[model samples]
Target: MAAESDAPERGAGTEKLWNETGIDPVELHLGKDSGYTLRAYRMSDTLPGAKAEEPEPDEAEDDDEDAPEAEADADAVPEDPDADEPDPADFEDEAPEDGDEEEDALDAEPEEVPVFLTRKGKLLVFREPAALVAYVRDNDDHDLAAVDEYADLQERVTEDDIVCDEADIYELDLVVANLRGGQEGWEPELLIKAAEVGRDLGYALKNDSIVSALAPGSPLDDLDEAFRVVAEGGLKGRFAKRRLKRSDPQQAAIAWRGVIAKINDHVEWRG
Candidate 1:
């Protein structure tokens, strides 16, 4: 991959780095020139172990001290007559129907999961998809048409859009690296291969898995959409077709590079 120093400023806190599989957490440091140096550490290294057991209290002394106090406290206060009586308002309002439980269950707020966008040496984190989308729209200089397509794509996304499992991690890494190389070094062949790999990866990883593995508003989501577009002979497909039709290898490379760059922003570090 061609080296580029486009990483955003490092935020404060202990950042957890992951392997290419986006599973195991590792300590990662950026090299002076290119790539990352990773260090693995066990969980025990950071967390404390179980505390030593405390001494047991004397059973005989405990019982003797509690007997008199328990009897005295119990005798001190008599139960109020009104304490047993149900509130008049409670009866007037009537008991809650069975559907109340279902209504309450429906009304309960859904849990929010955090999302992260990780690049070569930067990590952008967000809790909301809209914020991530807004950040991308404001900061990146991408094709407006492509951006709109991505926005429309989001609405159509279902739960089955992304999937990740232990077996697919290695393949995922290979495909992502292929795409990254196409973007960084402007290799047309790699871009084509990346697109092909993307289709398979898309099938392996549904939308939810992709978002959860990377970040909710990640560009990888758009890349998947781009792959679909290319497959369906859309704008990206036209760009690819034009690139392939060009006679000059250098010109073809340049054209393909532009096409790759358009979708490349979404490719990010999963770990």
Candidate 2:
């Protein structure tokens, strides 16, 4: 009876807002700073203003046309009249093979990626829930405002509604420490959550270092996969754990620390 009484106190009423909108609140703890922000995922081709920007033509090409032409060298070798003429077939466009077309289609598929509430490529986070609510309600300039559900959220959300689920709360501060503690002391779930958020932020912030560090074949990704395997608990997991034992703990800790620092550099805290 006592635990059930904290429904509104736990912001249960506001949970539906996120559920329906498919946008979630996330609490990020960066050791020295912590804040709340909104994040969502969408297909790359479906995101607002997602069109590719074409590069402008270079002025150097035009300058070359205006410059005086170089004089032909008198000492140059004369062309042989008997030489075979170049084949016109060489310049013709070749049709792609069936397998090549299939590969192209696969490569062109739109990927789903995280998008944060941001203003001018900088994520907008607030130290206080009220300030985050206020920022959401008052500002229409951010990337989140482009969503169809954002208007509904703006009208409905309050400071109390800004409360996030425990699952969405990430304690990145503890990542490096946990890694340096060695395989036996590592917490699988914590490291998994850190990887999830790190990947999301890597996409949201479009930071090259984060993307490369957390890429599918990267060392950090390998560590994440090893932790995932250990958490599953099976014969395969046993082998994965053995592999993890052989891995260097300090190297992983350093890599994660560098990624955390890169993320910290892009953060802008309000309130």
On lDDT, the candidate that comes out on top is: 2
lDDT of 2 by residue, 110-186 (tens): 88878788777687778999999988888889777777788988888888787677777888999999899998999
Model 1: lDDT to the true structure: 0.35
**Cα distance off (Å), candidate 2, residue 237:** 2.0
Give the number of colliding residue pairs in candidate 2.
0
**Which lDDT tens digits does candidate 1 get at residues 1-271?**
2322352322221122122212221111111111121111222212122134455568766776778777688789776977777778876866788899788765453332212223332333232334443444344332211222334333432222222222222212233334444433433333444444333323222233323322334443344444444556867777744543333435433433443343333333331
lDDT accuracy of residue 143 in candidate 1:
22
Task: Assess the local accuracy of residue 8 in candidate 2 as a C-alpha lDDT between 0 and 100.
Answer: 34
Query: Least accurate stretch of 10 residues (summed lDDT) in model 1?
Result: 25-34
